[model samples]
Target: MSTSTAGRPYALIAEFETPASTLHAAELIRDAGYKRWDVHTPFPIHGLDGAMGLRNSKVGWFTFLGGTTGFSLGMLMIWWMGKVDYAIPVGGKPLFSPIFAFPVSYELTILLGAFGTLFGMFFLNRLPRHYHPLLKHPRFRNVTHDRIYVVIECADPKFSDAETRKLLEHAGGRHIEIVED
Candidate 1:
């Protein structure tokens, strides 16, 4: 609402009346070979990721690595503690049997996998962000309510003010505006 163009340009955003239109715009942006873009909706939209041409997240890899490390560490710790450091054999059972270590290793795998998921999410999302240019946009708050938005950052290599606006307009976007930082 301040209509002041004095601030540095950050992004170009457009409002869509419905999720379907928003999805269409996202597809157009994606096919245009633009990176550094995002869509905002009041709630999750099915197939939006595919529309935006996104690949699967890498968080699962982190979880697998963490779980593997945890299991290996748990098994090694149990084996070293029982078999080498202080051998404790009872009832003719082996000192470092995997059967005995299975429970703790499984628990450790679960614990560390959970941790990996948490940390991976934080890392991928760039969490703890206190500010963004969009956060200051007057229209952006509507995305938390009934509105949907598609934003293309100025930093995107394919971004051009006129052509991007044309694409959004052709894709049924309305009230297209430049967001500033």
Candidate 2:
């Protein structure tokens, strides 16, 4: 979301020495009221979401809706097949029964719930991406090992090169550098 490809920077990235420093920087960024920023670390750090001001994910709603739809459809399909389509009564049992429908409904609930989680994540995170500007940075490759970083994207409305650099410096970030598109 950089403004242009004509030498505009995609983001500003800064390195932190430890998880504590990264977490502190994230809190500072959040307190500064800047959006469109993120933290990267070698491993998941405790309380990072709170530091970044993130709430619980909405993917659970998608799972609930999908499970409900699947359960309802499963019941309807069994009812239609048993009562209207064939209408065959076996051993004097009821033609449509909740007991019989439950197995299929449970299976469908599991299947659709899984699918909803997958697709919801793809939608929410903007998946199917083939590239990112961060991947072009030579030092960024160290993220998988021992490095922790905070990256503030250029697209943020509050982004200012000088102010953001100063903020990062104040938050204990080191090796701060602009990421060019």
Q: What are the models' TM-scores?
A: 0.89, 0.92
Residues 20-119, candidate 2, lDDT per residue (tens digit)?
Answer: 8888889999999999999988888999999999999999988988888889989999999999999998999999998989999999988888888889
Can you list the residue pairs that collide in candidate 1? none
lDDT of 1 at 178: 93
Model 1, 97-179: lDDT tens digits are 89989999999998898899889889998986777778888878888999998899888999999999999899999899999
Candidate 1 wrong stretches, greater than 4 Å = 1-6
RMSD of 2: 1.7
Score each candidate by Cα lDDT: 0.88, 0.90
Using lDDT as the measure, the top candidate is 2
